[model samples]
Every structure is written in C-alpha cells, then in structure tokens.
Target: MSDTVLDEWQIALKQKKTELEKCQKEHHVESCLKCEKLLNCEMRETYVKAVYDSMSKGKGGGFEF
Candidate 1:
C-alpha cells in the first residue's frame, strides 16, 4: 500500500470480475495445479484472499456456506 505500482494480482483484484474470469478460462486457476500463469505469479496469495474475502463479505459476491 505505497506509491509503488501495483502488481498483476493487485491490478487483478481491482478488476476482479474480468481478471478472475480470464484466469479461470486461461489457467483453470482453482483446479489446475500445473497452472503456468499461477505457478510463479507473485499475486497468488493476495488473489485468493481477495476472492474469499469478497465472497464472505458480499462485497463482490456471496456464499451460503
């Protein structure tokens, strides 16, 4: 959270819908263990946390369980 530029994952979070969908389509990010884009992506943890947090808080989505 500084003046430094945001990384790919941070940028993705800001564009959550498109970014997540694109990753899913291209890499099957959640299901693909051998995902190339995700294998070395530095934003992996932040991306996952952002997704789960969004679901639980109903910020961008919802979850029943």
Candidate 2:
C-alpha cells in the first residue's frame, strides 16, 4: 500500500469530488451536464473551485488556457 499523504488542497479536492459524485448518484446521472441544476448548483461551484485550487496549489492565479 502507498503511504503517501495528501496535502490540504488535494484533501479538499478529494472531499469535493466525493460530494459531487454523491450528488450525481442521488440524481441518477452519470455526468453533471445531465442534471437540471448544472448552472446554479452550489456543490458544483465548490467542486470547480476546489479543482482550480488544487491545480494552482492554493495560489490565486489565472491559467493561460
């Protein structure tokens, strides 16, 4: 087994991903795009933020993509 530890941002991203998946399961949808609340979902918003934070390592910056 791997003994690697997750840092704060990764931990938060993991948590948000779990919550997002749970919501999807409860809604019986495979993707968030299939959900009606795709636009105004707080869960999705937080999850997106968590993803960005994870990519940026908590550093506030814009990507060049």
Candidate 3:
C-alpha cells in the first residue's frame, strides 16, 4: 500500500481507539459494546495490527504481540 493510504489507516485506527476509550470512560456500555465488538471484529483487528506492526518496526512503540 502507498504511504498515504497507510497513514490514513493509521489515523483512522487512532481515531477508533480514542472513540473506544471515550466510550469506556463515560460508562457508555452500549457505546462500548459497539466499540468492543468492532475492535474484536476480524477486519478491524487486521487494520489495527497492520498499523501497530508498522509502528512497532519503527522507534519501538511498545505494542505487545
């Protein structure tokens, strides 16, 4: 994939992570349920892992396998 695409995906993943965190913090179980379900979804994880893997290859982002 192109760097621009990868960057966009990375930004999206970060946005999703932030949304999930907000839902969890606000005690929005329903929101969190949706977020958790998405996070656990195969496609979502794939994207997340791709971004994490790329970041991990750089200055060591501390992502656990």
Candidate 4:
C-alpha cells in the first residue's frame, strides 16, 4: 500500500479530472463548470473552482494524467 497522502488541492484536482472525464469528456480542461456544492461533496466550491481555473490555464487541452 502506498502512503502517499494527497493534499486538498491534489485531491480536488484529481476528483475534478475524474469528474471532467465523465461529465466534460476531456483529459484536461477547456471550460470548467460550477460546482456550487449542490452535490454536497468533499471538494469545496472554492477548491473545485481553483482546480478548474488551473485546468483552464493549462497549455493546449486534454492533459492526460
């Protein structure tokens, strides 16, 4: 078992990436959607937004993990 503990940002980023894959269907992120905490998920709205912002700024699109 790996002991790697991902920080809040990393976790949020990973979740967003996964969600994006199913919802957005993109490895990277061209456009980010609002979370609004409607789902009452662990990832906060601000954190999700931050990840979305980072994904949008990435060079090109569809950044595979």
Candidate 5:
C-alpha cells in the first residue's frame, strides 16, 4: 500500500467522486450531461464543489489557470 497521506481536500474529493460515480452507474449514464436531473442534482453539485475545493485547497477565491 502507498504510504502517502492525503490532505483533507483530496480526501473529500475522493469521497465525492466515488459517490458521483456510483450515482452515475445506478442511473446507467456515462456522463452527467446525459442525465435528466443534471440541473438540480445535489450529488453533482456537491461533487462540483469538491472539485473546486480540491483545486483551491479550501481557499475561497477565484481560480487562476
């Protein structure tokens, strides 16, 4: 097993990703774009938030490329 430890942001992102993938599988869709609940899906919203948080390391501000 890898000995590297994940930061809080990475851990949260991983958990959210797993949930999102499970939801996608249950819905039988490869992408959320094809899902009918794409607009109001709390799961997707949470996953998106997790993505942003992971990128920003919990820093609340605009992201730079």
Candidate 6:
C-alpha cells in the first residue's frame, strides 16, 4: 500500500478507538457494577482505562464496544 493509504488507515483506526472509548465510558457510568463499586475516583478511572484497552483489540470476537 502507498504511504498515504497507510496513513489514512491508521487515522481511521485511531478514530474508531476513540469512539469505542467514549462508548465504554458511557456504558460504565450507566451500568458497570465494578465501576459502581469503586471507592476511589482515581481507581475507577484506571479501571475504566484498563477495560477499554483490553476490549479495544476485539480479542474475544463478537464483542463490540
């Protein structure tokens, strides 16, 4: 692939990742029991970040953000 095409693909992938993170944050706020159980705000933030990182790769298959 040409450099331009590769760059575009990278950008699109990054945008999708951002969108996925946003959706996860919204869902966590609304329904995640683990998030609700969080006592410290920082820990909750870290947990959310970890969850996003883990699930963003589409590892388990059929699990869309």
Taking all chains together, each candidate's TM-score versus the true structure is 0.32, 0.93, 0.36, 0.36, 0.90, 0.36
Give one digit per residue, the lDDT tens place, for model 4 in 1-65: 97998766567677766665554333243444453433664434545675755666433355467
Rate residue 8 of model 4 by lDDT.
62
Cα lDDT, model 5, residue 5: 98
Candidate 1: tens digits of C-alpha lDDT, residues 1-65 = 57888655555567765565566677656643557766666455556666676545534564676
* C-alpha lDDT of all candidate models, in order: 0.60, 0.97, 0.58, 0.55, 0.96, 0.51
Q: Write the per-residue lDDT of candidate 2 for residues 1-65, one digit (tens) a residue.
A: 97989999999999999999999999999999999999999999999999999999999899787
Report each candidate's C-alpha RMSD, comma-separated, in the order given: 9.7, 0.9, 8.2, 10.8, 1.1, 10.6
Ranked candidates (TM-score, high to low): 2, 5, 4, 3, 6, 1
Clashing pairs in 4: 28-62, 28-63
Choose 5 or 6, whichever is better by lDDT: 5
Off by over 4 Å in 2: none
How accurate locally is residue 61 in candidate 5, as Cα lDDT from 0 to 100? 91
Clashes of each: 0, 0, 0, 2, 0, 0
The runs of at least 3 residues in candidate 5 whose Cα sits more than 4 Å from the true structure, single-residue gaps closed, are none
> Which window of 10 residues has the lowest lDDT sum in candidate 1?
54-63
Worst 10 residues of 3 by lDDT: 27-36
**Residue 37 in candidate 3, Cα distance off native in Å:** 8.9
lDDT of 4: 0.55
What shift in Å separates residue 32 of candidate 6 from its native position after superposition?
11
Error of 1 at 64 (Å): 17
Error of 4 at 19 (Å): 0.6
